[model samples]
Target: MLITNQLGQVLVQHVDYRDTCLLPGGAADKGESPAHSAGRELREELGVTVPLDRCLAVDWVSPDSVSVPAATRFPGEILHVFDGGTWDDARISDIRLPRSEITAIDFAEPAQLPDLLSPPDARRALSALRARLNSAGTVVLENGCPLAPGVLDRIGVLQTDRPSYRYPWHPGPAPHDRTVTQVWGWLFAPDGRVMVLLEPDTAVDILPGGTPEEQDQGDPVATLRRETAEEAAARFTNPLLLGHVTDPASRRGYLRYAAALTEVGPAQPDPATGHTYTRILATPEQAAELFDWGPATAHQLSAVHQARRQLGLPRAARLPVTELTDPITC
Candidate 1:
């Protein structure tokens, strides 16, 4: 079974016998349906009873393709992965682990799975995540490779290595000596989903802001407003300074801010790129997932949440991130 938390982190189980973490499930008992076995495994291992109705993935594992102990004859198997739903903090805390088989549980970020799990397990978990995120129903895989790969799968989202930048939030004003080279803002919709720009070809996530131009007169916020408008057709207000990350080589600060979106117009071509960016309203967690910031994502999320509270926006519900089809101005 594949389980996730409200923050979209996958629940991985660490067994005493394996070096790599696995999704919280075991082989089905004879005559027992896969869904029933999923629920049963959760109860016996994690001591939590979660519904397993939604099948997220179906994978075929060939016996000859995998390595196992000589005593353990590996019959080829078809794996059915059911969704365990999103667990809140309170529910996560209620989980209990047995001392023997499933020794520990971790809510791992999707990008971290490559390092934390075996190659096949990592691929399977990532494919499952893409299925859930895109509302693709269920994905089919053979030997952990998706048979019909989506854009995310082809781009190698979870399989890509992430860089660990120490983007520690600074409460104080940005240093006066350092030049502000670039500005970025998290433009929060009324529902709290943040607006981000995606590259037209690669679908690479980019924060909706850019470098300060001469027309901006060295104001970082002005740069933010201009870039947001050009790249996303978005207008926002009450910009709250989140913090800045200093580039040691350049002695410059990349300013980050959060603001409430006031209006979003129809998509238009950006003058700089000559391409209309693919605008998306992603949950803060989803933004983090797409960016793959490693551990620094927590710091950025904490700062964004604080700004959200200050701006009086409600906490965003856990919904699949959506793309604006025909945007309307507010």
Candidate 2:
């Protein structure tokens, strides 16, 4: 099983008998299940006992595999990689490694695995990392890439040739003239409806997002956190990069837009950006109807819905109209 910390570094162990490093897991004991064995191994090796969250990938390695030896006890092996949720710096500091079996223990970024682990072990770790970040189901890997049954489809993108529209009341210039980037979040409720912020004066509903600033540099997720807080005063969790879109007609002749799947928190007014907004939780159909920015707006909302469905989220249902209220005053 592959374990990673909050910084996205995979835990690796230096075995005294082997020249290359490996993930923190060993052969299952006589009555112990694979999952239980993983837990027990961690406790023995690192002095940490974390429940294996879920199986991320299953890889079949033959005796001829580059990482496997011909004199090995088993001619073939099926490895089940499990997700050990992020460990904070505090917990990471508490890790204690056994000296006899493990010479050293450290966290290495995914990109560094190739230099540290054997060929097959590197493939397994990379596959597990990709599955942990993108897919909800267990990914089957032949080498390092997905198997035949699993297809890697583009997550977010909607092509359009129409000239972009710029609102008269828009706070800044449009992206038609130069390249511009923006980050937004599709904040979904437990009930399945998505939250959209209503521009009180324009009577237009839009996702909680905005253009990046000098402070954001090039990090879209950081821009998302700042913009979401300013627009809706809402906190979100599990922000996954849904994908990005490109529109050639905007300010820099292109628009780089990214979205994340978010969980909405309480809404309040931002004192820094005194903009009045009405928070509305609506289904995809309602958002398509309520957004007054034209067909492009509706198309974007539909794309968001499709992304959610692709991520295995429940279908959204029509929300009550009564839930829509007047704009909140600062």
Number of the predicted model whose lDDT against the real structure is largest: 1
**Deviation from native of the Cα of residue 272 in model 2, angstroms:** 36
- Model 2 scores a C-alpha lDDT of 0.61
lDDT of each: 0.80, 0.61
List the candidates' TM-scores in order: 0.65, 0.49
TM-score of 2: 0.49
lDDT of 1 by residue, 1-330 (tens): 778775567899889997999888888888999889989888988889976779989999887666776557467679887888888888899898887988888988777898898887888888888777656568899978889876556655545433334454555457999888879899998998888777775556678999899999877888999999998888999699998877677777778999999888889999998978877777887677666444556777899999999999988876655677576654
Off by over 4 Å in 2: 67-69, 143-145, 149-330
Q: Which ten residues in a row have the lowest lDDT in candidate 1?
A: 159-168
Model 1 CA lDDT for position 25? 84
User: What does each candidate score in C-alpha RMSD?
Assistant: 6.0, 16.4
